[model samples]
Target: MIEHKDYCVPADTWAARVAGGDRRALARVISFLENDDPCGVAALKELYARTGRAHIVGITGPPGAGKSSLADKLIRELRGRGKTVGVVAVDPTSPFSGGAILGDRVRMQGWTGDSGVYIRSMGTRGSLGGLARAAYGTIQLLDAAGFDYVLVETVGVGQSEVDIVRVADTVVVVAVPGLGDDIQVSKAGITEIGDVFAVNKADLPGAERVATELEMMLDLGNHAAWRPPVVLTVAASGKGIPELVQAVGDHFAALVRADQLVKRRLAREKEALLLRLAERVRREILQSWSQEELARLWSDLAARRLDPYTLEERLYSVWKGAKEA
Candidate 1:
């Protein structure tokens, strides 16, 4: 268990190390936080003030959409331009091990020894919205560490992956051929989140068909400040990566011109603040109640003697009492 006295210290030290460009410290801090260590959160809070400096790019799509391959290519392209990159690959949790497999590392070996690039994998941990506070915190750490670009790769299913829109400065939605039904499903989650679309594996027969379908969909959507573009790529062979990178850069530049980035950042800040407040209340306040008190409350609730609103009121009262104590 991490003691309160030791909590702030590791966090502060790790924040400083990240600021100094210590890769290992950055990795360690992220790992610690991914495991929900309290000290890690403290360290993230300490380092949070230093973040919001890097460009955050989120890549998401359906499973087997070749998102990892596309990300690997994007990293290489950014590196070639002399830009330092940080990648956070969010993998699905294995029910048995309860840990991220980091399977995408197979294609990402190109950046293994490159000090200019930092890569880390994260698990969903049952966070429904693809938005893990830990992943967001890791991005902040990389941003504070002075990385030019930070890429967030999320598991390509459910509403959670689409939540990347709230966190990323530029969002890339990847899709593949023969996923006709997928495009429809995507409309519900990711269709609007994209600042750009990537039709990866352009060598495939149905690539053009997929591209045309996506273009038609985008054309039918409500007009925005900037229209999202679709780019084709065979990521394995590095085809069309340059165009993809340029599209990403151009989209970011347009966001700057429209001054929408500021609005997005503000909204993100508000959401993060509320989440932290809720977490604090749940932990320091609600948990202070004795088991007997909780059992009695639940018993009353089960008996329908207490409605949800009343229960919430009681919970808040308990919280207030704990604060006073």
Candidate 2:
């Protein structure tokens, strides 16, 4: 049903197809992106202008916190309200093949027949902070494809995995009962990033205790603009999911009412630009260093002739010189 002959290059054709709501084309481009292929990067560039529409919600928590189930419920809730959804579920990498070890695609298979929903599983690929390197690009592609919402389900590394804050319009920190150190986890930097705290598995005992702890901790911070509400949810049965969805909507509405949406987006854009620049510099430094040069530097370090700081300076100088050249 889709024509591909209009664009000359494969990237152009794929980009055009994606812009036209072709799911297959979008998946193909995302695959190319995950592999760091030039075509994928080119396609993203071509489709960049059409992005920045979808609301990106990030769900993250500790292992066994039911983040996936919460995401599933959120998708159903959103769809019930006539909104289209896209999901990027980040999982740990397979040591041998460097692919996603957890098959989120299989877990989210219920949506396979729904044209309005698209889900993709991504491996962290050794990137830290609970996300794949291609996550931002994948979100952009989904946004360009006209999805109403993009849910980024981070790897359940821990409460410290606040990287989702960098990409999500609303960062929902999922917590469950029986995590003995729930209060400590909240104090450990998650409270600062969370726009909504979801107490999933609310059916479990001590759920009220966990919510109270979160509320008490939030009271200490006294966030003026918007206070992150703690919503109780039993994601497995979809109980309290509607309230969680409403909490997310309220946060977005508050951001818009306060005229902070554009400000947050601007900050996100700046951070993304800086990250790309850093990656480019790192790539250039690695490419500029010859094997012998690297070996000599390692040899110098091993022989105690040079410190890591000095080697880093030398490498920076080389990168700078190459850029100038």
Candidate 3:
């Protein structure tokens, strides 16, 4: 974990700044979240009540599908509608630095001056998945900071990208012409997950054919009530953005009408709980064990005097909330 030891302020102070729309303060909290700081956790508890207002939209697809360009365009259009927007981009890891090489910020630098728009790029940090490990917590922080629309951009690869469904309220899967099935995007899983589809780079030669393919794929889907809409977009020039936003709005409206929004949120939070537990336990559980107990376990395992099962039982006992060895 990279510590931003600069943050010595109280969690409540950061919480106030976040609720008041201080971008720097919000960014600090997100950094703390990635580092798994107790201060960050405390701040989230302080501001958790202000959450559940932002509409989380996930943008994902195969690489070179212009997903980042589309996300940049959406931020512009969403802001034009008087909506405050937050963008969480899960970028590929940098080999040397092991940090996020930001693609979205570079494309959307025009909005950097606008305080209403907050964009964060997160690296996968060696975690093998389409998103940064801390992406879910980052979204909650943004929501509590009062963003009206939060757009999460996935690391465009393949089925690993389907992790977006764990956090997003409405998901947009972007695709381009000439992308074959080589990416191993589990066809059934992809179809069921996308709430909106965009055939980006529509000016390309095979755009129409690709859109048609998507339509046929949509027909095979088992989505009830709300069908995913395929919209063509030249994301670079901002074409078809309004219609795409409306498509997202339509899916969200359907979820609300069916009273499924709360249900989905509950499910997401439940999953988040498991992920958080896994992260925390992996990081701290072993370190918290008594050194004397660990030394005894190692000695017993090496001497061939005690069986491995007995040693395992001792650790299992500690894990089940026993303080004694």
- TM-score per prediction, in order, is 0.87, 0.89, 0.83
Clashing pairs in 3: none
The global C-alpha lDDT for each of the candidates, from Candidate 1 onward, is: 0.78, 0.81, 0.77
The sequence of per-residue lDDT tens digits that candidate 1 reaches over residues 1-325 is 3454465575578779888999778877776766666767777777777888788999888777788888888888998999999888766553211233465432566677899998877666555332367777888889989999999887564454336776789999888887775554346655677889999889988998888888988888885789999999999899999999999999999989999888888898788778766766776655777889889888988999889898888788977876687
User: On residues 125-151, what C-alpha lDDT tens digit does candidate 2 reach at each position?
Assistant: 544432444777899999999999999
RMSD of each: 3.2, 4.2, 4.6
For candidate 2, which ten residues in a row score worst on lDDT? 92-101
Which lDDT value does model 1 have at 57?
A: 94
lDDT, residue 134, candidate 1: 75
Ranking by lDDT: 2, 1, 3
- Scored by lDDT, model 3 comes in at 0.77
Highest-scoring model, lDDT: 2
Off by over 4 Å in 1: 1-4, 7-12, 95-100, 104-106, 124-131, 182-186, 290-303
Q: What is the lDDT, from 0 to 100, of the residue 222 in candidate 2?
A: 72
How close to the true structure is residue 150 of candidate 2, measured as C-alpha lDDT? 98
After superposing candidate 2 on the true structure, give the runs of residues whose Cα lies further than 4 Å from its correct spot.
1-10, 93-101, 104-106, 125-131, 157-162
- Candidate 2 steric clashes: 0
